[model samples]
Target: MKKLVLSLFIVLFVFGTSLSQIRPVYAAENDFTFTVGSNGATVTDYKGTDLNVVIPAAYAGTTVTEIGRSAFDTYGTGKPKITSVVIPSSVKVIQTYGFRYTSLTSIDLPDSLLTIGSSAFENNPLTYVEFPDSVTMIGNYSFYMNNLTSIKLSENLKTINGGAFDTNHITKLVIPAGVTKVDSSSFYNNNLTSITVLGNATTFGTGVFAGNPGNLKIFGIANSPVYAYASSNGHTFVDGTVLFQAVVSAKSLLNSHLAGTGVGQVPANTYNDLSAAYHAAMIFVDGIGNATIASDLDNAAIPLTSAISAFNAEIIKAGNPAALVAAITAAQQAMTNHPQGVNVGQTSAANRSTLQNAITAAQQIFNQAGQYLQGELDVAVAQLEMAIDTFEDVIITAGNPTALGAAITAAQQALTDHPAGVNVGQASVGTRTALQTASNAAQQILDNAGNYTQDQLDAAVNQLNTAVQVFNAAVIQAGIPTALGAAISVAQQALTDHPEGTDVGQASAGTRTALQTASNSAQQILDNASNYTQNQLD
Candidate 1:
């Protein structure tokens, strides 16, 4: 009789509804349905119909430690509905499918929570989620099909299983540095504009961004795993410092034009008149506050208007009607060549408006014998330069050195072909040479692959392994383990394809040892990527 009763209980436990009869323990005082277990207590089912449900920290003096599987799933019956949930600090685990297919638009998870079971909050309408620092693991499909626009990951987060944040409206993300392992599909099909990974574990599974747009910008330290992965896989790697420097350079180039002899062979006295405004701009740019780089840049750009006004007055006094017409024509030309062309989006539209305003203002003054100052032309050119920098940032994020090299070569060839239109100066020559050199280095490794002796392949593998160390360090710093997973996989496969002992020699033994070490390092990166700390892996 006991055996038969046990069999029936097992069947009932496997299905959710039967658990209610086994414990009829409703803490009427607390108005919650819970069952006591070895550890403490778990909320098995909710009895309230409030759209905003708050799970209590304790019921009947036992801390509510878990939310049972499918505890809040409506099962498509819609008998019970909830729009928001507040999880308490005492609850540690949320079991699988606990909140799946709900109308929930908001949720509050406490730091005490450690794991979120698969599909726990899938198909919700959540716009944002803030993971508490205590969270370690987020299961597969946990946040799948949500309308998430943003997510705040915990510093201690370890593993993010496949499809964790797939199909969302996420525009930007910062993967915490501690994350070591990420399933390739974890972020699949998301609208990601930028993703910054703190770590570089390289065992990325195939199709990591399969359904997502390919224009994702990856930011990380130079010579890091993020760089290697992005470079190898043809994603743009935004070198943080380099990009900032480019911004500074663009501003400086604009400033240089305003510094000396007011634009284009002006009357001798005009220089002195523009000097005051020029000096002010220089001082402002030099002592620019460090509140925010972009804002500071804009602040520095403001004084350029004063310099242009001073120059315009000079043109009016000189009565240079022809120069005024030329200035207006230049502004029109600038408006025509606006850096961001058609179909570029809202930012481009705004830029276009600003450019048009500059042109329109110049034109209004043109009929009054107003000449366009060099400062005004410089400002327009500066805006175009900034736009070019933006394009460069995107290209860097694309991270394909081969394509960059090809583009560089094509540009150089174009200059050679159209010598009259294109000026291939010293700077251009230097840039071309540098690009060619880097391209040759990368291409040599790829081009000679078929002819590589076993020993040569071993050398190449060693070099790649060295690159991996840099990636690992950056990954740990960034704390994103899954970041490097795919890169490591590709790199390791390349090394493994080379046969052993095909070209064993006097130095082959040493190469073999080195290869073994590299192989071990690669494996370690994969093994500890998702959850293990460096100390644990070491």
Candidate 2:
């Protein structure tokens, strides 16, 4: 009976019994019959002029098919009004601004409702809503500013359009598994405890779920898509993946560009988005503050405006846009206003006090790249140590000499390919001259070391490891890998162990002799790199 009544009433409402103006449905009231017989249907335009409107079920005999635009925008304002309304299920389409910004305190949407377009009930006083799986979408801001205590999405629903629930006052809600997304702020400032993302729902657009309920927390839906889509930035990401480090690191890389010089090797993490699109966003709250980064963000495939729009929508959906923006700006401003983009998101005394003390102990590395490029022997030694350490971790499992060799080559190139003569310290006439000789010798030895015996490889590895310990007495003496002299020892052993294998002794002897020379040369590069640090200390 209830279903039938709703169906027939809306049918007549569209065709009209209003003769003048039409209004939205009354709260929980469906007084007429279900079936509209079909008269040619009375003519009525549905702009905001109507007051206490009612549509008879069997209006002029035609079953109503559509509800017009702005059917109730500004309806019943300036009065304790909105006496009554009746809608028949025959009405299939509800247009934009329909029944929105009215004095409606409460209303029952019939189960027959299929579609409600954009801004339909924004600024209304509706306290509660129950979506029927039959309804496919609630357009952007359709229920924004409603005073609902809670909402429950219909299980059969496949799509809930963007901004469908921004700024509502719901305390709790359940998202049906069928929902592929929860557009920003669908529950913006409600009392929602948490949103239970269901089914295969994967993505949450930026700003989509932010500030929905102060207590609202996001949880992975069981069987939820591993990679969820970000509607704002449109990035498809795995759930629970950490991106703050990546975002901030990229910003730090961009920060170097601000100095307009000395921007070194790009961190691998910033290769993709350290561009115009990411920076152009007014969301400079995250360390992308300068105009240069903003221009870069503007030129990217995904514009900065859109990412923020998407995220803004999330904020709008949780609370009123005006309120959400203020809160977000406050939070963002507090973070970026600090120096170095360091501790970016850490606001408050607890963070300020604790972080200052802790960060003092942090060390800076790689910034001394120029010192290494200058062929400072210390820098070369350090580079070798780094390469070897990274290689051991790789070789222990993948025992591939080719891979280890490639790693070494990269380390060497860090110095050779450097544009400046000396990347590390103040160079005098002597060290500059020394640099060229050392570079040439080191390159030749590394190039020929492939034919080296196991003894040389082992010796090189040990030497590199010892070099990292700056205070190690062994490293301070004659330098590392160079001091090993593995080539000579291995060659002698080969001759003693394989007396008859002509190939073994011959190969060992040639390699050992070459290594002895190369070891002495490598020691010289180490001494050069260290000179810069010594100067700085002095």
Candidate 3:
């Protein structure tokens, strides 16, 4: 009887412990049903009416670390009304069918998530999904039969099981560098346009990209395993290395010449050319995994490299715009110095307009970056200098007109003092006419100062002054006999006083000879009085 009692007790204890181990410890918190485990709690089910649910990170003082199978799936009692769900960061694993056959249009996967069980999100209306870097394993048909148009796989993801992303609308894919294996039919039966494999040694199972487009492009390094696979599988293969290098070189060139107003800056035309080539190359680079042919990439790479080389060569031949820029600055300063207006000492409006035009043209040339030719820049500088000179001359002549006015006044006064006539003491008609003509011309110039240049005004002033001097010299003063006339009168008096015959109280033979000689000399001088002045006679 004692042995039987001991065996029964032992069986009961064993049975009790097994039952305890098998039966989950259930708890409820915030509309979540959790099964407590050794490490933490697992969310088993949600009994809520909210369309957008947020699973708690902890329940009953235990961290929720896992999502149990069929936790929100379309089982006997389904929660198909949930359109979106927010999984907490504490949850690392989602077991099979955790959210399968639900109305989940979107699901927020945390970065702490590690494993996604088979069919975890199968047959839903999801349009987009992205796996976090912490996720490594993706079970078969994990996102199968969905409306996923785009999916971003984790960079750290290693295994993509069969049918993991099958029967979706994925058009392009970039396999991460860390991915090692893609299982059979991993991305099958979709509208895939291209796939870029970053790793050269990544293995692909059969039918990994089956039922995609026939002309689908596979981009990778030249002669890589992915390339060989693409060739053997009757798919188009493109080597992206050359194009990538071309892009890098183009970017480097662009960065090196980004300064707008300094040494080594690129010309606008050349910079625009480089920009066009770089953009074209980027188009191919951006389309590496999508519809980009190898020949097209090759074409773009050659031009892109050529563009970079061309920019470098252009830099070597870039002309200096500093001279032109300085000239423009000087021209502007001159314009400021001689402002346009009708006031005295100010530049005329017309001259200022011309100078401003020239300055504008020069400025345009200066803004041509380093592309302007030396000849063109020199021409611009010359034109601006000419304009400045002209402007200053006008300001000096037309702007002030003081010298011209004074000259005209002096000439008029001389005319008033010396009237024109053929009389003995009056000015000669010819000299008076000449003086009047010069004075009239000068007066006209002074009256219309804006119409004449500084040179014209100066010439007029000089001519008028010369006329006045000539008129003054030509005039004979009253009672002041002409030099030849005075000499004749003295000679006549001597001749009358001293006769040539021998007479008492008369001059001797030598005196008579001297008087005759003096009269003859005076006669000669009187005959040519037109050539002698009063001072010469005296």
Candidate 4:
């Protein structure tokens, strides 16, 4: 019996030693249920009713290194009413579903956090989130179904799993240069308008931004993976480097002007508008404020450039009045050179009036106190110069009246020699009348010789000379008596052939009587040539 007791004692002692070496599956300390590992403790569950939970950095004498899967989830045993959480810096990893389906509106992610497991903070009411630079990986659906409108991703992030930020209110996002892989549907079904990917080597999975805005702009390097992905998915891709350059250029353009009313300065209102646009663009350049998107930068740059252009246009420039003043002086000198008068060899009153009007307008423009546009002054100068040239074209010169006076004298002598009557060698009444009319017109031109031009006086002289030649050609001559006697004989014979009362085809009784009477009168005139005039005999 004493040998059996000794063996049982040995077995019991061995069992106690084994139990002492083994670690507990979970140990409850304060409100946390954690598991101790070789490295540190991991919070496995929370059994608290606190609305604000602060996970201890050290639990059960070991540093808490992680938050275990489903530790504070809706399905967890405690189901605490957590609205906010303060994670300790001792935490490095948050396992899958660590804080899923919680009422968390705010959470402080510690800088020491390295990995976020799948659906770790899913179905929360988080409106904003910022991952620390130490975080490298984000698991699937990690921040799904949240109220987040903006998020700042960790610079060291390398991977983003499927549906990690799906179904949120995020409008803008920036994927840092260290990011390598973004899984399918990683940012799906959100309100994203702009996303900037800084890395050129990052690869994208299918539907990464599916169901987001159709006008979503993705910014990246020109030929990088993000650019390719955006092209294949029908999203607009903007080059971030180019956008930044544009912003810088716009800022530089705006700063080149000063705000004042002095020369070479822009108006105060114009400068203010440009300054506002520049400052707004700087927000995107510096990656702060709500203007953190690529579209924001684009929108800001356009207005800034427009404002700069407007400012430049409104700048007060000093206009040189020397050219305009010289033009005015030259125009006035032209007016003095061509005086207004109706006398011979002088400029017409109408031309002088036009020149004076042009000079008046130009002088008015030059009198303005340095507020006129150069174009306006140039137009005035052109008009005044044209007026001066036109005035010179209309000057009247002296015309000779001696030729017209001689023509009138010769025509009058012809009328005196060929008097209108029946006398032999005298002009016919019609020819004398023509010569008299032409002589009267030429005499009137000679009386006011200075009023008519040289061409007009020459035309009058030619007309009077033609009339005199016609009068002399049509004068009564010595052979008229013989011609009249022959004509009377012929008429008498015509009367004898067609007698009165006979129905001959040539003449009736009245026509025969008239011919006999005319023949008798011609015979009487031809016989008594001393008493009858040439017109009467004919």
- What TM-score, computed on C-alpha atoms, does each candidate reach? 0.39, 0.33, 0.43, 0.42
lDDT, candidate 1, equals 0.60
lDDT per residue for candidate 3 within 3-51, as digits (tens), equals 9999999999999999888732232356778899997899898776666
Give the candidate order by descending TM-score. 3, 4, 1, 2
* Weakest ten-residue segment in model 4 by summed lDDT: 285-294
Task: Estimate the lDDT of model 4.
Answer: 0.80
- The local distance difference test score of each candidate is 0.60, 0.46, 0.79, 0.80
RMSD over all Cα atoms, model 3: 18.5
Consecutive 10-residue window with the lowest summed lDDT within model 2: 470-479
Residue range 291-352, candidate 4, lDDT tens digits: 34555555656766676678768877766778778877887777676577755556877888
lDDT of 1 by residue, 143-172 (tens): 999999878887688888888888888766
The C-alpha RMSD in Å for every predicted model, in order, reads 47.9, 35.2, 18.5, 25.5
Write the residue-wise lDDT of candidate 2 on 235-282 in tens digits: 222222112222333344455433221223333333333444354422
- The prediction achieving the highest TM-score against the true structure is 3
Off by over 4 Å in 1: 1-32, 77-79, 222-225, 240-538
Global local distance difference test of model 2? 0.46
In model 3, which regions exceed 4 Å deviation? 1-30, 242-289, 295-538
To one decimal, what is the Cα RMSD in angstroms of model 1 from the true structure? 47.9
